[model samples]
Target: MATQNLIPLLIILVSAILACVEAQTSDQTSWAKRNETEKEVITTLQFYFHDVVSGPNPTAIRIAQAASTNASSYLFGALWMIDDPLTVGPGPSSKLIGRARGLYGSVGQTDWGLIMALSYVFTDGIYDGSSFSLLGFNPVMKSGREMAVVGGTGLFRLARGYAIANTYQANANGDAIVGYNVTIVTYV
Candidate 1:
């Protein structure tokens, strides 16, 4: 009876040991594979972003805002969800390339700053079906704003880099066209 109990315990112990060994071996194998097959590639891309907030067919819309958001000079606490178009040029009629879809909120009280969480999904050329994530602060009032490129999918897998945005045009209604220069490093 005691031997039967010991048998189960021994089986459990052996199984746990095997699992641990397998996990270690798997980790080592993956590390080796990554070292052998992965090569770091840096790519730079330029594009234009169109943010239309007030038009018949707007691409960006104000989803939420705080009670005092309108009272602030910087429109603090205003949150927007956007699906803006990315084009080859600043003009609306420029060649469509991708879309910038995500959320951004005014987080600055004394300045026009936004906390943006966005993904640039490419739909043209070699990058078709690939997308990279951007998450960082955007000081809109500045001449150039830099944001981090955190991660990506498809061809941009394991991507990390930065994006520089410069406002090309802005109107009274808050619609704007911005130019983006992004540099990213990805493991291929």
Candidate 2:
């Protein structure tokens, strides 16, 4: 009877030891695989987009005339100049690295709300293919509006990220200056 009891105990002990060994081996294999994978790079890039919006073009007027009053409709585009806050000016600055094209429209009263799509082209910096594009709505009277990064090329190929836009300045004539802070992640 004592022998029978010892046999069961011995079997249990051997099984436990084998399980522990297998677990350790799996852990080591998983760690090795992680080391072989490429590391992800995280970076924050700051830039400003100063837009000088005036009035709607003929196309803008046509759309508004079909939908609502002209005062509530606007279609505009601007050349974004990338610059630091302290040295914000027209044309291009030494810090100027890229330009963005934006198309915006207002559907509410006197351009109270706007929907926009933007295409950013970068000639300098670590961005791939010299550019990345994004499309989303411009939240009216709201700060820190977020937009999705659709696609990119070069270093930004298969890129995925988000951008925050804030209005830096607005004039009575409807011209405004906006700031953009974009954060991106990619594998190197």
| Count of backbone clashes, every candidate in sequence | 0, 1
Question: Tens digit of lDDT per residue, candidate 2, span 1-188?
Answer: 99999999999999999999999999999998876796776667677665543554211122223323432344222212222221123323536666675555554454455665666766664553456667666676789988877766666665678889888777786556667788777666
Per-prediction TM-score to the true structure, in the order listed: 0.84, 0.59
Candidate 2 regions exceeding 4 Å error are 1-36, 55-67, 71-94, 107-111
Deviating ranges (above 4 Å) for candidate 1: 1-33
Pick the lDDT winner. Answer: 1
Please write out the lDDT profile of model 1 over residues 96-148, one tens digit for every residue. Answer: 99999999999999998999999999999999999999999999989779999
Overall local distance difference test of candidate 1: 0.95
lDDT to native, each model: 0.95, 0.61
